[model samples]
Target: MERQMEPWWKKSVVYQIYPRSFMDSNGDGIGDIQGIISKLDYLEKLGIDVIWLSPVYDSPNDDNGYDIRNYRTIMDEFGTMEDMEQLIEEAKNRGIRIVMDLVVNHSSDEHEWFVESRSSKNSKYRDYYIWRDGKDGQPPNNWGSVFSGSAWEKDELTNSYYLHLFSKKQPDLNWEHEPLRGDVYQLMTYWLEKGIGGFRMDVINFISKALDLPDGTIHPNNLYGDGSPYFINGPKIHQYLREMNEKVLSKYDVVTVGEMPGATTDDAQIYTNPYNKEVNMVFTFEHMDLDSGPGGKWNVQPLKLVDLKRNFEKWQLALHKVGWNSLYWNNHDQPRVVSRFGNDGEYRELSAKMLAICLHMLQGTPYIYQGEELGMTNVVFPLLEDYRDIETLNMYKEKMEQGISHEDIMSGIYAKGRDNARTPMQWTSEGGFTTGTPWIRMNPNTDEINVEQSINDSTSIFYTYQKLIQLRKQHDIITHGSFQLLFADHPSLFVYKRQSADEEWLVVTNFSDQREQLEWKDCDVTSKSREIIISNYDTLNTNENTVEIRPYEAFVVAFKKGIEN
Candidate 1:
């Protein structure tokens, strides 16, 4: 594919906000658009160029608004369309772009279209969703929902099973239907016309289901079957995306990003290839799964440094010449990076800064999930009752029936639970959020690790992030440089170089607690009179031909051609 002119998004840093956890305006306890609008200046101070908010679309609160019931309306809890419009305009005044979450993979079962479809078998909206007959007394196939149980939910009224890859409240739409596709395109146009910046497509890869609707490989000792191969990255996905670009997205100068759960490097290249006109970039789960065990996310394991280096090397190299990558460590669906990959105890601040340096130094657009800058940690809810995510609740029930002990499940919840990231934004201990109760409790360590404290301490993780973002803006090499791994086999050190025509930058990171050597002799690039540009540590340790990296130390240096000390 031919390259096109680089867009503003490629050079912009994105901040993701889980609206419900950000802040609350009214005493009702849920976060609203007015809350987000009030925090616009705070986000601007953090130096974010784009803000991507998770869906606030009309919904029944199942799956946290992923089950959108109305494309044009805002959820009642979030406020009205007027509030959203005000948010867009206010954000623009601060030079910040607002990217809305587009969750068309499914619609809430309570949606008007779904209600009409379920009314009768011959309804005009009947074909808007995927419907099939049950076999004998079971669902259409052994496909299981991501939450739990069968992906096919029986419609008691229509006597047919409607497909729901997630919670039963979310029914998947059939992309094969011509009129449905037209409707989606028109909906996108409506948003662009309203002056919204762009869209962050939710579960976009699952839109085109394998038309055959066949049985899947069943998992022993598990309720759901592995039916992902049939629907994920389906055959006509590219066709559908290209059609989307042609019909709606390309008309606006805004950026588009798709959340692809199982997309590969090749798929990402095609999707973001400007010539292909699919998207500007994509969020892939390849790097995030490095610590996953045999049972997947819940069954967690220690992050292997080799596996991590390999994952980054592969994606960086594969996309360096073709597509672009989106760098991130935490999101609404995942736990905090410091707690998951770094030391959350004695070395929390050091490790958080190191992780930030390592990811931002790469050749890609970097995203900062809310609270990540404050070095926030995962919340370990004591009992299952405290959890709010649907997936977390279902996993507890399914594992309990299978005889897994509560202690074992809670251990996994501590490591991989979605609630870990859903904790209320720790602005302050008291009225920073609301006088009312938070939808979910704030992280108990708020007094020590909140925005109020971070903003005051110059050495805090928040400032470190600010410096990294500023570096991206100041250096062209950061946006368009080629990435090369220096120590691919090193277990503790993650070292790489980004180079353009005349500039060279070396990024060295110690991802562990042990102090390590720079080992310049073993690396690919030659040593120069390098000036240390950024580092987590306040002091530098240098020797004859190498530098000593303290525990969890991260530093970036600019290399000059031939200067001798």
Candidate 2:
């Protein structure tokens, strides 16, 4: 029998680059395609197989690149179309593939299609977007925008309101229309034909909405209502995605990951099941939202290690053979992982490595966001004007209007604002990103934490990430082994085991700042010969039953299944 081959993406590691903050080669203060092309060597050195580039499409900068104006053209600030093509070619030259951001749920109101659709009620493109008549001098529904306020925007020319789940400038597309879906398919085909690797879809689950556009339940403390129930993973989401796969995705040999905000484990199984052919995997927000209070993302709260372990165990076992999972710690819209989940002040390097080992050792593909390998921390801008994220600014303004104190609002922003991940990449101490002033302020601690410094130090977080990536490629157990969570209820320790037919790997991580002990009776290794694969600490000691774990320390021990002591 012929040997079977698995998908290349299953064994690959991805690195996400927020183009606007990655690098700037033209001294224009904004990262561009040419800038990314210049750093191909750096990414190659990191051993990442795919570069998940955030949106670089034409936009008005209202919500950064997320609100795209043109799907085919590159943003002027990020360079021309030629530069983008060069980036694709250059990245490929270094054995790296580029994954573009697919933002089909909505487009900039300034887009030609939206402009034409809103030009007149009788226009041919009017059905390209979601529009409905107002109700009693108000919006069509009491839906709230993800960026706050109402989700409806009135248009005087058509005498109607258009739905925008995010920014008013981003009018949601009418996926119910056949022609609109065809157009999106064609655009996707264009990129895939251009030698791009895959796509990281933006809010893909929100593309389908309830046809009635019903009003959501109103929260007592809020102005508008929660509209996610009507839009997220709607009635026809599967039909639309299956159609999309058949029309565009199935023909290509590329990977696809959808960013689903409200997706549950069951929903994810349906979306990512190989037989369904919807997507290769989905980015679930369950783990990310664990640190939030009932008030939502801005309501900052401490993360419980037990809660995190249980959540991971549930997903790992639920999707083991049924589907796949996409693991990540930080992204463009999230706060820095080190500052949020690890100790960024005293044991930043050790904590960062621990977090990496905990996630990478799981049974899924891992993503490393820009500057995450350097152990970047959250930036606490002193003033509201210093913050640039629309969500942050809107929350501050709305809270102040409700008689909230400046100190309280600022504290939340410092702890959970999206701008925490938008700081420029720290390549060096002296304005490494650009010659001109950065669009957003650089983190003040960039002097001590940067790629240059990290790469030189053997004990830096960058090397730890590099070693983890290398391990995934070298060991089949890391990719195909079954996962089992040990010490599930431990308050400060995360312990897991991955076992294959003839190999077993033990991954232990200390989530707290204090030393802990791992004494799992079921995970005894007295007779098996053990090898320390990778560790954050310089020295380690382990006995047959229990191991003494230092503060924020992590290590992986490998054993040959049939070998004796």
Off by over 4 Å in 1: 1-5, 524-528, 562-565
Model 1 residue 520 CA deviation (Å) reads: 2.8
lDDT of 1 by residue, 1-565 (tens): 2224657787789999998988889967888899999999888888999999999989899899898889889999999999999999999999999889988889999999899999999999999999999999899888989898889888899899999999999999989999999999999899889888899999899999988888888766776679999999999999999999999998899988899999999889899877899988899998889888888888898889989998898888888868788999999999999998899999999999999999998888899999999889998876688899999999989999999999999999989999999998889745377678888877788878888888888999999999999999888888888888887888999988888887678899998989888756565434555678899998778755778889999999887644443
Residue 432 lDDT in model 1?
73
- Model 2 pairs whose backbones collide: none
lDDT of 2 at 38: 83
Relative to the true structure, candidate 1 reaches a TM of 0.97
lDDT of 1 at 294: 81
lDDT of 1 at 254: 96
Query: For each candidate, how many residue pairs have backbone atoms clashing (under 3 Å)?
Result: 0, 0
**Best-fitting candidate, scored by lDDT:** 2
**Model 2: what TM-score?**
0.98
Given candidate 1, what's the lDDT at residue 232? 91
lDDT of 2 by residue, 1-565 (tens): 1213777888899999999999999998999888888888988988999999999999998999888899999999999988888888888889899999999999999999999999999988999999999989999999999888999999998789999999999999999999999999999999999999999999999999999989999887789989899999999999999999999999988999999999999999999999998999999999999999988787888999999999999999889878998999999999999999999999998999999999999988999999999999999887788889998898888989999899988999998999999999999976499999999999999899998998898888998899989989988888788999888888998989999999888888998988777653456553247788999998775566767899999988887777654
